[model samples]
Target: MAEEKLLEIKDLHVTVDGTEVLKGVSLSVGEGEIHALFGPNGSGKTTLLNTVIGFARYHVTQGSIWFKGQDITNATIDERARLGVGISFQRPPTIRGVTLRSLISFSSPSLTDEEIERTAERLDAREFLDREINAGLSGGEMKRTEMLQIILQSPDFVCLDEPESGVDLENMALIGKAARIALGRDSFDGAGCRSIKSRRADYKAGLVITHTGQIMDHIFVDKGHVLMNGEIVCSGNAAELLGEIRSHGYTECFRCAGCAGRRA
Candidate 1:
């Protein structure tokens, strides 16, 4: 049997300020799979995520975005979001005078108070929700808030950009737990230790973009792709590629094999 495709990008080309950022880039994520995208700064990781979210500023000069078997290349940001696509930005926006509870309640009206508290507690974000969206929020607090949104939305596909960026080691485990919950690996209370096996049976997919591979250490990443100069230089299994990246930095990897002479 063939695998179901959750997202498909074909020959994507993007430009910003009249300069091309993504050139002939293509990628696919299947249901329930976690795929990591690794690249150095300015390699277009965030730009790619922005394009996937249908940001009008990042023009897709040529390409197509297929989500859950439908063509959404031309869809607006709101349109894609209504279709169960969620994005956790690298720098979450601040909402002045808007409490976190209000924001979440506005986005997801179905969540009960108890459910909201549980989700917030699991993500270590219970205290921050009472405050403004990002007012005086520490790095960890911001990440937790983002995780809370993920739980509330329960999106079919999620794109996380640099989730571990400013998080400390103490809160890293909680972040991992939240991600597992989103992936359906284990529940908020750790009831389903065996659910990791069952979680792989579902069709929830995640696209993670990272500069540091710290988050990959906590989860089971299925595949890894190296992005350089706005395009994928090579693809490999998670362990092997991660190991290579650990032993040798992006500069070495770029000159190793598939991307020796590529220019941005």
Candidate 2:
């Protein structure tokens, strides 16, 4: 049986600030699956995520992006958000005046104050709720807040960039818990108490970019793709691919015709 694809990109070409960053890139993330994207620095990993989320500066010169059977190649960021697409940025900027609690409230208005408090408690973020958005936050704190926003938004598909970057093992575990809830891998109120088997059909989908592969310790990744020099040159089992990359750097991928042939 074939998996139902939730997000698809066909031969995507994107440029940032008039310089091409992605070249003929293509991939699909299926319903209830999480795909890890592995690449070296400046390998267009972040570029791909920004493009998928409809960031203005990432101009798509060719190809199409489809979500839930609709072509959204030219959709605005707000339109993408409305269509159940969300992103957790690698380095989220600080918003000087907006309180984190107020922002979360705005994003998910139906949840009562108590419900918000409980959710914050689950992420170990109750103390930071009153702080200004992304202001004076440690790397781990910012990542946890990103997960909290994703959980509250409850998007059908999400793109997370470096969720484990710059965080210690302790906070990494918390981020993982929040991610599981966001992806419906665990029940919202009871993080690890319930089985996802009962809710498999409606589980959220995700694409996560990782340079270190440490995020794998927290979440299940069904597949992986390696992007190099603006093109995807490898695709395979997430853990195995990570192992190979760790043993031999990205240069080894160039020798494997089977992996590099994926784009051909």
Question: What TM-score, computed on C-alpha atoms, does each candidate reach?
Answer: 0.92, 0.93
Choose the strongest candidate by TM-score.
2
- Please report, in order, the local distance difference test score of every candidate based on alpha carbons: 0.82, 0.87
Stretches of candidate 1 above 4 Å error? 196-199, 254-264
In model 1, where is the ten-residue run with the lowest total lDDT? 255-264
Across residues 140-232, which tens digit of lDDT does each residue of candidate 1 receive? 889989988987888889888988888999988888877777766667666864744555647468889877778887678887788888888
Q: Candidate 2 has which clashing residue pairs, if any?
A: none
In the range 99-203, model 2's lDDT, one tens digit per residue, is: 989998997788788988888888888888999999999999899888888888889998999998878987777787777777788765563624555656677
Error of 2 at 87 (Å): 1.2
* TM-score computed on alpha carbons, candidate 1: 0.92
